[model samples]
Target: MKRFASITLRLLISGVLLVLLFREHDLFADIAPRFHSLLTNWHWTLAGMGFAFLSLFLASVRWHIILRGLVPSLPFPMVLQAELISAFFNISSVGVVGGDTYKIMALSRRLPGQTMPVSVSLVLDHLTGLISVAILFTACMLARSSQWNEIGYDMRMLITGYAMYVGGALVGLVISWFSFTPSLLAWGRRTFPRTMGNPKLTGLIARLTQVHAVFALLWRRTISAMAVSTAMHAAFFVSFYCGLRAVGGAAPVLDVLTSMPIVDAAASLPVSISGLGVRERTFEALLAGLAQVPEAVGVSASLAGWIFSLFWGVVGGILFLRAKHAAHIAPEAQCA
Candidate 1:
């Protein structure tokens, strides 16, 4: 019954999302007629897509660095594979949960004896990445102060909410780090008392501390990771800049850069699966007053981003299936 209810809810969400997406825009007029223009602008789109994927790869590499401290002997390819697989699932209707779980399972399987530590590393990797995004986006907004003032109230609220959420996460991490043993142990015991009863489980829990140690040891590298991510994120903005240009729109690069993170973050609020309706509305609302671009153009650009994300998700699906099949066919040790 619970599974049925969950499925029903997701379907309902998808329906509402579709309505939201097509609500304001004339789907046939705004989207269908734009195909030729999009094709003509394919160069920018392809370039943007390439840069986006490259950024994701770089992120995976940074994640691997964090993982190394947890499971020193784990293969790099294994980590990358897991990340790709996870990212693929994350973009689907299952949302972030499916992807995160897939990632944890991959790490657990690949590192065998280091499951807990690897899990710890994944959490840390996610935390650091979110922090990195916040720092980079904040810098982008500050650099384009004038543009910041022009953003709508809805967007400002969204950005503020995201900032608070990330801030809260950082606070939680600090709290966890300082008082790691009791909170984590209690949580683990409550959730997995049977596992906690095993000696190996105690060792796994201890390994989590080792993972934290790894994070401390590599704290410096996190700066480098954020630096690289900043460059990549800038590259992402450039993609959008070129994309807008390709479509003959007049929005400035700085405007797009400053506005995008907030808009993107806002659309992620589960108001729409894959951010379909929500993204279009946010983009139109945010960009309409600031720039002379048509709502359709902004909507078109958002649609293009959705396309690219779905493409990657499709790739992830293939990997998910491949991993599933390999799990069954391969030796148990090979999974590790």
Candidate 2:
């Protein structure tokens, strides 16, 4: 029933956005020509796909670094396989929960008795990824502040609010790091005896504490992981920039860098089906409002990005199927 509700919501949001986007323009008239143009520029499309793949690879490497602190012996190939499978699930399902569940289940099967630590590693990897996005978004906004006057007062206010939100999140993380003491866990256990009395809850709290300790121990590597994450995000923005160029849109690099984070953050909300229509509209609004591009060109560029991402999704689907076959064969091989 819950899953049904989720799917319904996704479809509703996607349908509404699709209508809103195409209500004024002739979809066949506007989009078909742009798509034809995009196909003619195969070189840019291929380049964008290459950058997208590079970004995914970098993200897998970043996850491997985080996993090393928990399971040092875990192979890179295994992590890469899991990451690809996760990506497939993320695209197919409504939200990231599907991908995260796949990661946890796959890792648990591979490493018995280590699920707790494996889960911790996944959480930390996600946290670092968010931090990197916040940092990059903030930096791009600052670097492009001179152009803010062109975007109007409303957008300027939105940018200021986003920067403040990111800054507050960073400060909160630092405070949490300092405040994560063993006594905090002890106090929670004592205060909520009934709640913590559940063996599962107690175990989860214990694992969280262990995660905090491990994070402190690997502070240097954590910083390095953030660097790698930033590079991954850079590749992502570059991929979008290349896609935009492919569609004959000459938006500046800083504009792509600044606008995409907002688009991405909006799309990641569980409001639509993989952010299908929401993403396109966001691209249209941001690119048109900030970069003074035509709404049609903005939508075209967004469609190009969607095409590149869908190509990778197809690859991830193949990888996910291959992993299933491998998993099936492993038991037979072990028995033989």
Candidate 3:
């Protein structure tokens, strides 16, 4: 019942926002026609599609690099297949940890006793992406430093809020990194002796401490993974720009690049289904403030970018089915 209520509320929120967006714009005239232009702008559409796939592929490569560091015998093709299948889950819930959970389960099955290491690798994989996002957003903001006075106060606050969120996330991650260390664990036990006295808490910390060596397996590769992911996210933002051109909307490369990090972060928030209404609103608002672009174009481009991503999600669905079928076939063949 709790999960049902959460889903219902998300559906309601998304429906309400979409209705409000459309009530202010002519759907048949503006949004629908722009979608049709995707076919007309075939060149841009293809470019967008290519970039979208490149982003997904690069992400897989980063994960493969991290996981390979730990399990040197794990084949790249196996890791790549796992990452490709994850896209299906990623699109399904957007912000939920479906893809990550799937990867953990699948890899844990193969590796047996290495669940902690596998989980750590996935966590580090996402950390690299977040670090890249913070870097890219900062660079873009610096490049636009001269236009600070032109941005509205509300917009400035919004950007500042996002900056704080990124900073807080990094801080939390750093604390978590330290928590896996003996020094922080000892400090925690001393700081809150009573709380740390609980049997469950002690057991949990003991388990975590046992896995401390896994960090050594992954720590050095963090830099290399971040380097790869920077290009990965750059491809993703450029894909958004291609989506804008696909819809015949105009915005400078820098403006689109700057606007998308905010859009991506907002869309990753779990309030709405697949960030349906939220993505469109954030994209439209950022472009309007940063580039003086029209709302209609922003909305259309946001939807276009999502649809391009959804294309890969659909492909992943097929791949997932094929993998499942092959699994079944291998069992039957083994019996024969």
Candidate 4:
């Protein structure tokens, strides 16, 4: 009942926000024209989807590498299957790993005593994607130069927010590093013996220490995974750029690329289900600010970008159900 209510609330939020966007932007008037544009430029839509899938494939490969650090026997097909399943549920998506709680929990159930290790793997996976976001965002900012002033205050604020988010993540990593270091761990154990006595917390720290070991042991694999993550983000940027073209919008690819990381970050926020209204609103503001893109085109292209995610998510849902029905693989299959 609690879960149901949370879902209901998210649905309400999405509906309210979208309705507001439609009214504010006069999106009602552009609905017919937007559909007409998409129908006519179906090829770009198709290409965008191809890139989205390519991004998915790359994501799977990266996850597979990370898992191999802990679960060496884990198969790539299984990792791919999980990505598809998680994609549909919006627990994870194209470009960003998002909150990988589903994947972590699923893996934890399988690994039993190794829940912490599995969690560490997910952390590493998320870190790879996050580092990529910081890199990509910084690159975009550098590429934008002073013309960035053209995007208006709201857009600049969004960029600033994203920068701060990146900065915070970096700080968090540093703190995590300190906490995990041998000296800090010793200091913590001395300073908080009660916490050290907590089996659960102690075990978690132990698992994190093992993660440190994994990093040392599998540094090459870690690098490979991050490299793949970077390429995956690149694919997502191109795919969204394709969406604008598909919608008959003239937003520059560079500008679209610059804004997309922000769009994805906003969408990844837990506020809206599958980022429905939030994604549209954030992208709409960006396109309007960055390129003077028509509100209709901005919204249309945003939805168009969502289609790639939706398409693969549906495919994943099918695979998920199929695996669920198969008695033999159900236990292992659902872990993905």
Candidate lDDT values, in order: 0.69, 0.82, 0.86, 0.81
Q: Please write out the lDDT profile of model 4 over residues 57-165, one tens digit for every residue.
A: 9998988898887787777887787787788767333223433655666566666776766677776887889988788888888988878667678778878988998
CA-RMSD of model 4? 4.5
Q: Top model by lDDT, which number?
A: 3
Candidate 1: residue pairs that collide: none
Clashing pairs for predicted structure model 3, backbone only: none
Candidate 3 minimal-lDDT segment of 10 residues: 208-217
Displacement of residue 229 (Cα, Å) in model 1 is: 3.5
- Report residue 305 deviation for candidate 1 (angstroms): 1.1
lDDT agreement of model 3 with the native: 0.86
lDDT at residue 313 of model 3 (Cα atoms)? 82
TM-scores for every predicted model: 0.78, 0.90, 0.92, 0.87
Q: Write the per-residue lDDT of candidate 2 for residues 105-179, one digit (tens) a residue.
A: 988989999898788888788778889999899789789868677788877776677678778878987876655
Better of 2 and 4 by TM-score: 2
Residue 269 deviation, candidate 4, in Å? 1.0
Residue-pair clashes per candidate: 0, 0, 0, 0
Q: Which is better, 1 or 2, measured by lDDT?
A: 2
